[model samples]
Target chain A: MDQFLQLIVAGLATGAIYALAAIGFTLVWQTSQTINFAQGEFVMLPAILVLTAAHLGLPMGVAFIVGSVAFVLLFGFGFKRFLVEPMQRHGVLPLAIATMALSVLIKEAAKNGFSAEAQPFPSLVPDGSVSVLGAAVSVRDIAIFVVAIAAILGLQAFITHTRTGRTMQATAQNPTVARILGVPVERMILLTFLINAALALIASYLISPVYLAKFSNGETIGLAAFIAAIVGGFNQIRGALAGGFLIGLIDNLAAAYVSSAYRTAVPLVVLVVVILVKPEGLLGRKEERTV
Target chain B: MLFKTMAAAIALTAAMTVSAVAGTVKLIDVIELSGPGAPAGTNWKNGSDLAVAEINAKGGILGQQIELIHYDSQTNPGATRAAVQRAVDEDAYVVLGPIFSGPISASMQITQRAGVPQIVGGEAAAFTRQGNNYIFRTSLNQADSMPKLANYLRDEVKAKSVAVVWINNDFGKGGRDSMIPELQKRGIQVAADIATESGQADFAADAIKVKNANADAVFVYLNEEESARFLRAARQQGIAKPIIGETTLLGAKVIELAGEAANGVKGHVGLLVDAPKPTLVEFGKKYAAKYGFTSDHNGIKGYTAVYTVKAITERIGKLDREAFAKALHGARIDVAQEPGILIDTKWTATGDVDRESFLIEIVNGKPVVKATLPMINP
Candidate 1:
């Protein structure tokens, strides 16, 4: 029982980090209708930036914020120039290739520029573990989980309340109609790229301490995010959260109940079953496709 | 007619002389000068450069300066094979490392058929004793080292219940496979042996399993990247048992990534302390001055490999591959490359070398030399 509760806490905390990464993936997919395979690279920005800042002896917080905002803009501009422009003329395949290429480029650049060695993010939370029930939970895990939940809620509020968010949604619903209604489709698409990049940075900042900031961590995180996006239905924001938590739960539970060797494999199995049952995802709505 | 024939003979003699000195030995160093997961603070580039530099500075071997041709393999196996082939095509007399087990294994066949003496810098046990005289390593093989790991767990730490976590690659798999049988023989109860993917960032699930298994110690075998992440995740999940494994964890990244959590982890590595070897101290001081950081296992391995080549080359006095290979076997040199000051024996066999891996534990957040365990076989 105690062990079970421990697994749940550990899984939920990890699930939150995956949720943030998945949300970024979903945003790019929903707005652009093309997956930015480099979405994980955007997520690794803050950690790299922080590392760079640490090398320069800048304060951790300042370095993180500057790095996060700078990368968000850089990635946003890249999407606008490379992905959106190419997709407007040619097709989505080019955009996919471009994003994957970007992923490789960004990974190599980070390794060469920031030093490929794994560097720790300076700890923000106090080093302590609190006993909840019989399971001991580290302060860092709790902080990460709380930050993830807060970010998700904040994003939900932004989408529901903000004019730009609604305009972005309007653009997603019908790009032609949204343009007819004076919604800047190009600008909204750019905004989506920025949002995805920013969210990815946020996720990196939260997760780097828990998982050492690796040069190729983006690929690892990206794969989990892809799994989450698929399980949650790429079109549904709530689906991402659901998918992330479900995958995380299955990962932990499987390790405990089954075999640790299949920790990653088991979650994938559950995701496949869920996808089979509901092709639209757990909370996703069916969308009409254009021929 | 006599005058024309004398002119032709003089020209022919000049051509023949030019071709004779072409016997100058060209040794190719296929080492990784830069790549991901390289050892911390290692000057492999400089170490490699210094070997050639010293050899050239001392004057040409057989009237030809040893030419060191280097190509970065990026520690990839495919790249390594290509690099080896390039070296062979370039007519290199001998080839030295593109470190990392996979690359070393991949390039073994290429060098063997070409009769090029390939001095590798990795210790994966599966890589050794390939039934070819061409493949040789100064680094200790897994079969030779892993039994010592099991012995350390039983005798040094007195660990009873042990859980093993490793990457599924040849390096990790070899270590895990060798240790398990030996560990069982020591009457140690094996707990959970969890395998994780190489280059993975999140290891929370694996950490939980280790915690749940309640093992007294966790033996983790992975490259630097995954090992560092695993340590951080294990700490976050509150799974604290003295983590010990391969020498790769002694890198700066591992210590930096794990930070406070890296305090007590133990690992196996070549002895780094200063001993009677005058060259080692001189090399150490020079390396620190050149690279602006302290040396790691790779620096020593690279330095020692060059020294071994020099010793063997000096003994043979000629660039014969078969002769050099024969000299490498159990050839003893008393010069100090590592602390405790003894080469004691030259690598007479692929399985045994004059190498000793000292037990290292993190003391004060740094890898301090612990007790030295003599080679079980060598």
Candidate 2:
């Protein structure tokens, strides 16, 4: 039983990272009606950027913030220039291909700019492990879990309460109507990209020390988050977050109880099952047969 | 009389040029110089070059000046195979490297089919002994290296339970698979064995499982990038057990990236880091002077391999393929240019360099000599 509770805590911490990454995926899908295959790379960029800046003698905290800001700005500008314009001119698939190219470019650039070697990020949380009901839990896990939950709450509030948030929802609900009502759909879409990149940057900073940051670290999150978005229903943010947590839990439990070799396959199986049972997803509304 | 004397002078000059051309030994170096695998190749090239430099300085080999032709593989297997074919086309007597397992395996088909001799650095032991007499590796095979690690865990660190984390590639999987039976033989129980991809950076999920398993120590087999990240994450997430690592962790890059986290970690290294033999020390000093940087195992392995070729060539006294193989198999030459303590051994008829290994320990943030294990041949 103690081991069971411990697994849940550990699962939640892992889920938190996936959740943060999944939210970014949901944000892009909600506004743009397309998935950014490069979203995971956005997460990895800040960690590498912070590591580079810190190596150049900047304070770690300042370097992290600067890195996060740089990724956010890059996402906004790049989306406006390459992603949005080409997507508007061509179609969604072309933009997806463009984002993939951007992903490959970021991976190679990081490998070239930074040494291909892995570096340890300084830990943010305290380093003691506490035993609760016979299971050992570290302070780092708690910090990751709390930060992930807080970020999710903040995102939920932003989407529901803020002016830009309402405009984003309006654009998502009906892009034509939102533009008719002067919602600045293109600008909202770009802002959504910014929001997604910033969130991913935040995830990178929080997780780099605990998770390790490699040039391809971003791709792991990006691919997994794509699966989570699909499993949760691309239309709903809550569903993405829930799907991420579900996948994380299933992965951990599968590794612990079943076979560790099948760990990767478990989350994939979950995605497939979710696709079959609830095409609309847990939080998503089923489409009406209007015709 | 004056015209006849001038004709004699011209004839003498032409004869001397022919003799000088006849005396040069044609050696080809197929080294990985740049691209994704440059880190490994760069060091190998330094070693190979240093060896060539020293040989030339000592008045060449077999009374003929040695000529070295080099082609870079860029760490890609296809590129490496093409590079080997290019070397063959250039009429190279022997081929030198395709450093990692992937490239080496890919290039072996090309080299083996062509009946060319190869001295490689990659440590997939099975790759060298795959019934190919033309292929040989100076590096310890993964099979030879893992038992040493298992011994270190069982007898030295005294960890009873160990967790094995590895990348799913041939290198990591081969190491992990070999380690299991060896560890079991030593009475050490494996708590968990997790496989992740080479390009993967995050191991928090895996780390948690390792922690939950109550493992006393962890064995990590991965590339430099993944290993470094795994080390950092393991440290940050508070998995405070000792990490026994594979040879890839020997780079200074691993230490720099892992920071204090890597300080006490124990790993297996091919070359001892302490003051090597006096001959190696002198060579190192001169190499540092040339490259403006210190030498590592990859470089030294490269150096030793080229000289091994030279030494074998010198003992053979001729350039026949059968004679060269016979000399390489039976010949022994102590290389003064290597970093660790290495004694010469005959290349087995199977075409593998039979060499001994010493154990290196990184203590208090310095790689120090812990214990020396003589050669244990299978």
Candidate 3:
């Protein structure tokens, strides 16, 4: 029973991180009809940048701020102007292909520009765990879970409650109609990208202590996030949240209970079953999507 | 006129080749210099550079100057294959390493086809079993090393049951597959057999599983970084059972990364810098002076591999690839005879080298050698 609860808590903590990344991916998709395939890589750079800054003798707080701003300017804004803006004109296929390539570019650049070695990151909380009903859970894991929930709540409120958030939703529904209604579709799109970048940075920061700052880490995290988005139903904030936790829980439970070799495969099988049952995803609605 | 032109070209080729051999025997060092394998590859290269400089200072291998060329494998199997092919085409006297198992497995056949002696740092069991006489290892294969590890677990640790947590890759899987049976031979039960991902971040689930297994000890078979991560996770979860592992778990990188979490963890290390030997201690100091870092087992493998080439060449009294390959098979080089090889070493018929290895415990972020296990054949 203790072991089972341990797996559950650990899974939920990991799932929260996945959910955060999935939310950013969903936001970008909703705002601009652009699937930033480099979503995992988006999270990877800030973590690496922060670690690099920290290694070079900067205070942790200063490093985090400096790394985040640089990451936003380089990958978020610059990527928007140069690559995403230019390629988005070609078609969804071309844009998706370009982002995938950008993912590799970012990964290689991180390796060559910095070091390929995995660097340890300090935990946010003091190194100790509290007994949650008999299972020993790390203080850092609990902190990560709490922070993710807080961020998710804040973002959900911003998306639904604020005027700009509703306007952004209006743009997601129909860009032409939103533009005609005096909403700057382009500005809304840029805001969504920036917001997504911020979420990505937060997710990276939370998870880096667990995963370490590795150049190749984004691939698995990105893959799991995409699965979560698809499973929970894309374009729905709550759905992405549910999807992330579900995948995380299932993945961890499977690893703990079943063969660890099938850790990745089990979740994928669950995803296939979910897809078979509901093509639109658990929380997703039927929408006009490009074939 | 055409025949005369061909004859002239052939004569020029012969002259160039003769001069190349007479002046300097070309040895290509093809290893991972970048990417994920950079930590291992770069160390191996630095070790070779150190060995090459020493050998040259001592008037080269059999008085013929050693021309060592470093080729980067980039840590990719495809790149390794290409590098080996290029090395063979260059008429290399010997080809040394692309350390990790996957790259070596992909490229060793190229050198085998060319009948060039290729000394590798790869520890997978399958590399030696491939019937490629040209392929040799600077370290013990999984088959040779696992038995010794299993022996220590059974005889010294007195483990009745063990939990084997391994990374799901060539290196980890190979070690686990070889090790489990050895444990069983000593009548030790495997309480849990857990396989893990290569770069898995969260080991909470894995740790929980091991803790639940409630085994006598946990054998962590993973790459260096993963070992550290597992150690941290294990410590955080407070898994009080003894954690045992092989060389990678005792690596300096693992200890550094794991920090306080690494304390009291014991493992068998095949080539440790901390071993109480004058030669190893001296090599470690010289390597640190040159590279501004401590040399790990991979560095020793790289350094020792070059000296092995020199020793074999000197024995043959000429730089001969086929003869060198034949000589290294089932060969024994005593440390008294050739101190450059560092350890008194013996090679099996299948090209797997055997030597003394140390069992060490990490104390305050340094490996303290507790026991030295002699070579099975020795």
Winning candidate number (DockQ): 3
Per model, how much of the real contact set is kept? 0.51, 0.35, 0.61
- Each model's interface RMSD (Å)? 3.1, 4.1, 2.0
Question: How close is chain B to the truth by TM-score, in each candidate?
Answer: 0.85, 0.85, 0.92
lDDT of 1 by residue, A175-224 (tens): 99999999999888887777777778778888777666667778767877
Give me the runs in candidate 1 sitting further than 4 Å from their true place. Answer: A56-61, A126-128, A182-187, A252-264, A267-271, B1-25, B31-46, B58-64, B251-253, B273-282, B336-345, B375-378
Per lDDT, the best of the predicted structures is: 3
In angstroms, the error of model 1 at A221 is 1.6
Candidate 3 lDDT by residue in tens digits, B1-378: 999999999865653354245688788999887766676787789899999999999899877778889998987899999999998888788899978888898998898887788999988898888789999988888787888889889988999999999988777788999999999999999999989876677787888889889999999988777787788878767788889988888887777667777888998889977888878888999999998878889899999999999888888776667788999998898778888788888998999988898999988878999999888777
Name the TM-score of chain A in model 3: 0.96
Per-residue accuracy of model 3 over A1-291 as CA lDDT, tens digit each: 988887887888889989998997788778656677899998788989998898799999999889999988887788777887898789778888898999999998998888777777766766556788977777777788899999999988987999998988888888999999999988888887788888888889888776778898898789889999989988788989999999999989988888676778887987898889987678987677556
Residue B31 of model 2 has an lDDT of 77
Model 3, stretches more than 4 Å misplaced?
Answer: A55-61, A180-185, A289-291, B1-22, B33-36, B56-59, B63-65, B71-79, B334-339
**How far out, in Å, is residue A114 in model 2?**
4.0
Q: What is the TM-score of chain A alone in each candidate?
A: 0.93, 0.93, 0.96
Q: What are the DockQ scores of the candidates, in order?
A: 0.44, 0.26, 0.47
Error of 3 at B82 (Å): 3.9
* TM-scores of all predicted structures: 0.88, 0.82, 0.91
Worst 10 residues of 1 chain A by lDDT: A81-90
